[model samples]
Target: MRERGFRLIRLLEYAGLLVVLIATLAAAGQEIALMYRQGRVTVADLLMLFIYLELLAMNGIYWRAGRLPVRMPLYIAIVAMARHLTLETPDMNAWTTLAEGGTVLLLSLAVLVVRYGHIRLPYRDEDPDNIGGRRS
Candidate 1:
């Protein structure tokens, strides 16, 4: 029936997600090893590694719960922006640094907002009309 087909598609999607997560981790590990061997652990390198790890973790968490929380990626973005600013040379304009720094602050706020929602206002309704606590 259609239900079975839908389930099969979901299974396939989950499999693909797993593969993508594994590949990301593998690539991140390779990059980390290269950085280590080269005796270089710059801010940019660390940020890239952290982003990769966060993505892989997010994928795993989603696979388990059939949901992806918004906070993880927001935190990752904040870290990435910080790294971008840190790696920039002194000659970079003040405005550029301030813009990137402001972005990081916004991302941090987003993460905090999402976390507060999940913790302070846990979703309890299961009605289809209120899917994920949103009007459908």
Candidate 2:
């Protein structure tokens, strides 16, 4: 009975993942429509779209591999910061831009560190199903 319950849970998880993936696709389509309506695509808009794409890709990768790498979101963060700079170009007070850029740099370093740690210390026995994914 316990095994059957576990299987049922997995099935439910798969269903949920599918729904999310479909929503991601739908969102992408909406973004395209929005871009068309806007007449001109700015750097910030492009970066925002890139972030969305990365998020969808990450979700897919995690569903398949049971794990998500740190680098993907780090890349997204860098893009997001740049996007912010572009979006706020007219209103930027040097100090705020500096702070945001600094934060991006820090997150970039964190991505490198996380990559190194993962490579040096691969997933261990504590990993559920040995897939290097969420523990629960």
Candidate 3:
């Protein structure tokens, strides 16, 4: 019964992942269509597409390995902040711009720190294919 319950949970997780992947792809398609209608692609549009790609990649990694790297969401956050700055700069006050930029900078620093830690202090039972660092 426990095993069956675990299997059911895993199935639900996979179904949820499938829904997210499909939604992300559909959003990307809509964004592309909007770009076509506007007849111009700006930096903000590209950044938005990048966010979509990162999300898809994150989903793919989790689906394949059953784990997610800590850095993935940080990268997404950095890109998202940058996108927000680009989209809002015109109407935002100088202080607001500075604050947003600082947030992105902090996120970038976080990514660097996370990468450095992964490289400099890896887990004792690290698996190249697994992010969970589970011992076998």
Candidate 4:
């Protein structure tokens, strides 16, 4: 029974991953179409595209390794906050702009911390075949 439950949960996880992959691809396609129609891409659009790419990367890494790194989401968040700030800058108040900038700064710091931890303290049984390989 326990094994069957585990299998069921795994199946659901794969199904969810499939949904996420499809949604990300569809959104990316839509963005590209909009850019094509407009005949030019803005920085905000580029930042949004980066967020989509990061989401796709996160999904791919999880699908391949059965684990999602903490950094991918941080990268996505940083790009997202930047995109928001870019799009809303014209109408945002000074305090709001400063708060958003601070949010991006905090996310950047989080990425640094995560990277530092991954380098200074890693999993004991790290997989040799993984992309970064085992860290000493």
Error of 3 at 134 (Å): 9.1
lDDT of each: 0.80, 0.80, 0.91, 0.90
- Candidate rank order under TM-score: 4, 3, 1, 2
- Clashes (candidate 4): 0
My TM-score estimates for the predictions, one after another, are 0.79, 0.77, 0.85, 0.86
Candidate 4 residues lying further than 4 Å off, grouped into runs, are 125-136
lDDT of 1: 0.80
Per-candidate count of clashing residue pairs (backbone under 3 Å)? 0, 0, 0, 0
> Can you write out model 4's per-residue Cα lDDT over 20-131, one digit (the tens) per residue?
9999999999999999999999999999899999999999999998778999998998989989988999999999999999999999999999999999998554453443
**Model 1, range 1-136, lDDT digits (tens) per residue?**
8668768988998998989888997999899899989997877887888889888888988888777778877877877787777778475898887877788888888888888899998867454345556664
Name the lDDT of candidate 2: 0.80
Error of 1 at 60 (Å): 1.9
**Superior candidate under lDDT, 1 versus 4:** 4
Better of 2 and 4 by lDDT: 4
Q: Model 2, stretches more than 4 Å misplaced?
A: 1-5, 125-136
lDDT at residue 18 of model 2 (Cα atoms):
83
Against the true structure, whose TM-score is highest?
4
